[model samples]
Target: MDTKLIIIETTTDDKEMANKLSHLLIKEKLAGCVQVNQINSYYEYDDKINNTVEYLIRIKTLSNYYEDVKEFLSKEHNFELPEFISYECKEVSKDYLDWIVKNLNK
Candidate 1:
């Protein structure tokens, strides 16, 4: 079977937490690369609509590391209920895919 490439996504309201998580993932070799972007999110809770600014963290890694990544995020994330979503890359460039595989811990 081909190597499964996935992009795990999560959000955080704290900038420091986002940076910390990104660094931890890369340093631990759980993620090949991590991208963080500031975003505005609108959601409803307790029958009230709320809008907040957050940091969107996109983690690039292999499927084999998903569980580790999830665990790390769950433990380090500041939000009560963090968003842990993964999207498999159906089509990736050979060069990019190889780079990701090479960067991840064996």
Candidate 2:
């Protein structure tokens, strides 16, 4: 079977948490690359609209590692309900895909 590439996304209200998670993922080889971006999130909760600044975390890894990555994030995340969304990459450059595979743990 061909190796499947995936990108998992999540958001945290704390910047420190975002940085820490990103570093941990990389160090543990759960992810080839992690990106943290500042973003504004608007949602409805408790019958009220709320807006907050959040850090978006994007994790790139192989499909085989998704479970491990999700477990780690679930254990370490601070949010009551952290966002854990994964998108399968249908198209990726050959060089970039090779780099990801090379950097990730076997």
lDDT of 2 by residue, 1-106 (tens): 2368899999999999999999999999899899999999999999999999999999999999999999999999999789999999999998998888888845
Clashes of each: 0, 0
Every candidate's lDDT? 0.92, 0.93
Candidate 2 TM-score over all chains jointly:
0.95
The digit string of per-residue lDDT tens for model 1 on 21-103 reads 99999999999899999999999999999999999999999998889999998888998889999999998898998888888
**In candidate 2, which residue ranges exceed 4 Å CA deviation?**
none
Best by lDDT: 2
Candidate 2 least-lDDT 10 residues: 97-106
TM-score of each: 0.95, 0.95
Work out how many backbone clashes candidate 1 has. Answer: 0
